[model samples]
Target: MNKPEKIVAEDLSEAVTYPPEAFISREYAEAEPDKLWSKVWQQAGRVEELKAVGDYITYNICHDSILIVRDTPETLKAYHNVCTHRGRRLVGNNTGGGPKTVAQDKGAHSARGSQMKFGCNYHAWTFDLAGDAIYIPDKEDWQGALDNVCTSLTPVQVDTWGGWIWINMDLDAGPLREWLEPVASLIDPFEFEKMRYRFRYWGIFDCNWKVALEAFLEPYHVQGTHPQLIKYGDFYSFSKAFGFHGQTGFDSKAHRDAGTAVETSVHRAAGDGDPRTTIAQMQAEYWETIGASTSETLVKTAQRLPLELPEGTPAGEVHQYWMKIAKEADAARGVTWPDLSDAQVAAAGLALSIFPNVNFIPGPTFSLAYRVRPWGTDPDKCIFEAVALDRFGEGEEPETEWTFVEQDLDKWPYVIAQDISNMVEMQRGYKSRGFKGNLPNPWQERKVTNLHRGLAHFMGTGHLKRID
Candidate 1:
């Protein structure tokens, strides 16, 4: 992969735009498997899902399927999820979903399991969870043919971080921690591994995977896209690149005008009016709209703040008081919070855009994350998934499972439903001859440009578009 020439906020102009082809071109989508997915560590599933030996999950990217298995109490392994005999999928055929494929993969044909061995019904070739071929159907019929063949399943590099199981197809790829970089360090203070899944939502979308991700990368669209939210707080943003990754968050006008280091992800919303009431309303709105991001305890605490404190309380006092009450409530329930310094929490920000295809917003006791994947080789179709994580007392974690919802906007929470509307429109707008390319907010949408540069880099290409 060639190094991506750096393009900073100062280098951006209207001409520095991503062409529609970058989002809707079939040619660009087809090259992703080799140029993007294979070169990066892709998150597969959470560690909590595979607590027992033999437990496994199948992750599908493009046309490839990877099987991650817990082979022993302390060992986890990953492999090509295909049978060597005839190239049949070891688990159900992940055919990217359709009524026909669903019918084809049911009963004896479909499986995701915890078993001592994965026995291929095709000729009864069996392999243990460790991916070693322990049994074969015919022993002596092809003794010489089988003797020299290394029947071990093809292995992939696998590791864990933030309670996620990440697999890299490039056997020589760098460690997950290193690849995650300052982004990992920025959010590690949140102690995500201690949180449990509060909810998981997934659906097929009529947009490029990148389109879905970019929608959440910045709050620049808040006034235009979610105008109703503006009454709660100012959503002006400051975005910046961080090596291979980037970050965007709400920042004060003072910081934005003075050109100081940005630091306002966890800060309370403030307007000309009583900031305490404004922030309280913002928390309540977040709970009702996205149903995640902020903790329920905090939102409830915010609702009762007016009665808890006298009128005209200082903004700092309100924020501190709100946190104090919420923390006490959490402690009473045994939900331990991370001992994060104010700086660490602020730096973590509203969200992080992990290179290639991951985005997350971290909080002390709650967080929300997104992962997008292309649906087969189609640029205009993708699978978008969202997960809500929250700290819970020991043994009190709620049992949750991945749930699929239809693409109908009503099926999603109000805020995300609005985002989906934008995603669909943006994909459709690519066909417009009048529009040239995206005019990103250089100061607030730096992450979007940084991401494109990362994609261009790994694909061994110059900028995907040039004005002249």
Candidate 2:
């Protein structure tokens, strides 16, 4: 893959102005279903979730509910979740087996087999996997009423790419692969389909969907939002746009500098002792303060680094050693690490923003993926879902469920919690009378600008002109 050319903030000649009301207006939120959400292909669920012929999952976006089902060993289908008879929802649970009835229920009968079918709880209207109306009561009541009506469940366009099931409500919408564009090609080598979800979390935030989505698109917030990370790497980032999407790459110079500076400081403070010995002692104290031992990866990586290095050893030597340790660790876990270039390995932790609603923090062995969507019609509240995926050897995939985190927000991982801490307050600030439109840092926030520009294009707003 080609590395993205870094562009400085001052060199960007165009500025995409975003109005403040876009983040807080109910009318704008209401218009999204038709203008944006309906027209775009959105990820419905992971392909692994519906492996069996009868397995199915329901994905709800705003007021739209879609039922995605695995109809055969190789065929998957998606349909509107509403029963045609009375518009009642066909599936109430997030995921479950096909329609069946227990013998103990008063009005229930058994259609108990592996072939999944959807039975509306309201009137027991049954639809086959293909979404054809299979059974309905009182068939003679209105004999001609069903003659001209297309009673079968309405199917939305469905496709799969990168092991994800994507659905678009607009039947005329472009193909999924075409919509994904450069992002699809950029990440194709990672073999994301081989990864399984380690955990899935959902939280309701008092902020716009864009506000929540934008939080992960850039690393500039690291210095203020996550000060602890500064010691590990530089907060300065390089960003590049790909029309509808963009990515941010971090420079690790500060981390290398810190290693050497710490060594010198420790040597000076400890008098004539070997500098390596002094540095080792300092590392022990620092790790204790940060509680690094509690994290298995941190502990393993720390153990591999020499506690005492030669006085003139370059920090690159330490980084090379850590990479060696990482490879060994993966080998022990039965994982075959991908063949990646030096630049690709360096950018393993880069954050990428896919236009509309998805963002990813890609890693060599694991990745953190996020999806943000408006919750119902409320402009101030949105649903934020996070999924952590890890590469596992064959037959070792984890069995996980969507765990809602809003009830106990404190349970979220530290970095994620820190990012979330700023969201609610930021949303409140947007409603303040004194605030004006957003003023994004041209280079650091270019991804945010690219995202809004995509939104404008989809919403029929004027095209954002880029001044050469």
Candidate 3:
């Protein structure tokens, strides 16, 4: 049989010709920061990360440092990280308590329930967790008068779903679910509430975040950039689309059936603890849904399928939630265990991308969550971060091993060191003067074009004007 044609779909020549400056320009980055960051909602962090009554986390959105705090068991409130009194950053680091002592003053009860206030580190001006000003230290000494009304921490908009918190910089923006309505149900089933945070790694790519994001939205690069991935899996045509807050795309098919015989067990790494029983139960339940198989078969199947949802459908983060469940299922059964025989009842990944920034790719054994923040318009210099949650079975964590077709590190970054190497260089090349955009073969370029369209929509530029 003739070899399948390689899809060299992206027209790199044309893409590069659009002045690189357009993407990396500082002016572009600074323009409409609020409109870009606030007008749309962004993922803040997992809700459990801020479990305590006073627990809080800091987030950097469009250069603004935001402090998000839990005011009630189910309620999360956000505020400007700046202290109203001295303009100094209020909360520092990821998350923390106000201080050793939380002083109580005024009509607020210091009994330590919900009325606790936030005190400035500099002058000790106090504000409630609700971002309301409670007291000014030495009120009589200052002027016997202090404005409690204006001293409250500036409040920002926030909401929660799938046990994760989302904040909107634009207080004027409508409800988050209103925006997420288009893609929520599509991703909610993976039971994210149960998935453990297996590990987290970061890479600083010289390339723009958009480039980094674009890298994972489609499998077109599997044959070239990821030669090993190509070796292990077959690339199906790509399909993608955009919705209110994000985008969704995936490979056409990997031709593997769930009942295949590629089962291989995960290695037992020292210090890797046993799996969790709850997770194992969840995994078993998942296997009952999707059937058991090796990671290779599972991934290939995942790649070939479109999200089992219709285009432009709204679901409450169905993919990530479902992913947490699926990962637990895979971990419970073991990466390569064949105990999963109910082929009729397996739950696999249903990856989706939320426009402009997030790409939610939930695999059976793991999931890849990415955010594509624009560095510039050139689309090459943006900052991209890929966080992989490698979920293992319920009881103990095993020393996980990565498997790919070729041993080349660059092509398969699943191992960490390799992913960073390519990201850095790709960022540098965004500034290459010899640049020109390249042509994208129709079959492989679906995700790229879909994203371009999404960007153009948000930029409010006419579709024809897209620099693609």
Candidate 4:
């Protein structure tokens, strides 16, 4: 009897090395829409983006366009953005016009609509915020034929978590919270829903979406990519998998004690030895470079460390005093801090990723979030975006818009621009015969490999035979 030889996977990621083809193969890029993106829940925009009842935003992933609208204060609805009449995109990606040499003080609006309903710019097929096909210009001529066809925009699953609107095309997939799991449970105490966007920027990059995303998934690259930042204590961090999602956290005494999961210090916690000057210096560097992880309140409080604490104060005590002062300062400004317990406060990361492509660095009062999308079927292109979020008093939230800057990386805040500069070159290097696949730091990059392991689950991975 003849039997088929079973195939096995040669996951380089499992061996702390990333298979280069995923970043360089068109076939892999083409399969992702069906094998990955469509099956997962991805963030579209913040709940705040749809403040007014009729406000709507368009999120594009691969070839699919999703329209998300705020139907009412309590309801949000999502639909395929194509017009039912002629299949023309009902919305355009209005990621155009912004400064080149440097970033601007404000962001402009994304493809958005505020009317009670949307009219297809092509044929004027109008659909209400609920995606109900309200008007057909020549309904009488079409007769009952339209009945069989979905006259209404096809409904897509939509949900809100952590103040972000998410869309899922797979009707069979679980609810957003269900998929979120321990990752959400770990971060829920940070109360991300209370934060609003303070900075927004997106641009196309000559790299795979996963490549762009992997840049933020771990802090292991800090030494090579950000040498200047080494002066700020240590960027020491490790990664842990939470089912499909992953988190990278800084080295902590607590983790060392229990030998378990730890999170990156977005707060840039005080290090060993005297804490007075070191903690304040770390806070200032964060403010000057990325400008989001530590809030202005925390940065201001850190500045007082030298005067508030004696020269030889222990790092642990310094952390407590620093937070006490920051919380009081925030309270004075009517800013309500999230009610995080001592344990949760000590172990959250500077970075975490949700399944396919959403990454975030959670902090007490301000944080940074990132999203990456395929720019088409091109294995070498992706849409990269970063956002800054802050918790503010009742009415202090600033008005924000989606800003798209061109290829000039100089405009990005110092540290981010440095990261971007590495992307295009990395993609090019991956194609070279001399370059081997990526070797990730085992413990620190478990989060990066999880992305690959997840793809293999849906796509069914197999490996090539080795040479003798």
Better candidate by TM-score, 1 or 4: 1
Q: Can you give the TM-score per candidate against the true fold?
A: 0.92, 0.81, 0.64, 0.89
Instruction: Flag clash pairs in model 4.
Output: 249-263, 249-264, 250-263, 250-264, 264-349, 264-350
**Tens digits of lDDT, candidate 2, 127-160:** 8998888888886787767842477999899998
* lDDT to native, each model: 0.79, 0.66, 0.48, 0.76
Q: Provide backbone clash counts, one per model.
A: 0, 0, 89, 6
- Provide the global lDDT of candidate 3 against the true structure: 0.48
Question: 364-393, model 1: which lDDT tens digit per residue?
Answer: 798899998888888988889999999998
Estimate the overall C-alpha local distance difference test score of candidate 4.
0.76
Order of candidates by lDDT, top first? 1, 4, 2, 3
Q: Rank by TM-score, highest first.
A: 1, 4, 2, 3
Q: How close to the true structure is residue 58 of candidate 4, measured as C-alpha lDDT?
A: 81
Instruction: Please tell me which predicted candidate would have the highest lDDT against the true structure.
Output: 1
On TM-score, the leading prediction is: 1
Pairwise lDDT winner, candidates 2 and 3: 2
Which is superior by lDDT, 2 or 4? 4
lDDT (Cα, 0-100) at 438 in candidate 1: 74
Q: lDDT score of model 1?
A: 0.79
Instruction: Write one digit per residue (lDDT tens) for candidate 3, span 1-468.
Output: 112123222332222112333245455455536446657777766666776778776765444667788887878888877888778666543111111133322111001123245667788877778787677776677674556666677888888865567888777888877777656654454444444445333332455665566666655555665454333334443343434333323232552333111111110000112222222232333233222211322333233213443433222222323333445555546643222322211222224667667766543344557665643233334444444454445665543221222223443334333344566566567567766543444444555555654444455431322233
- In model 4, which regions exceed 4 Å deviation? 1-16, 94-109, 252-264, 462-468
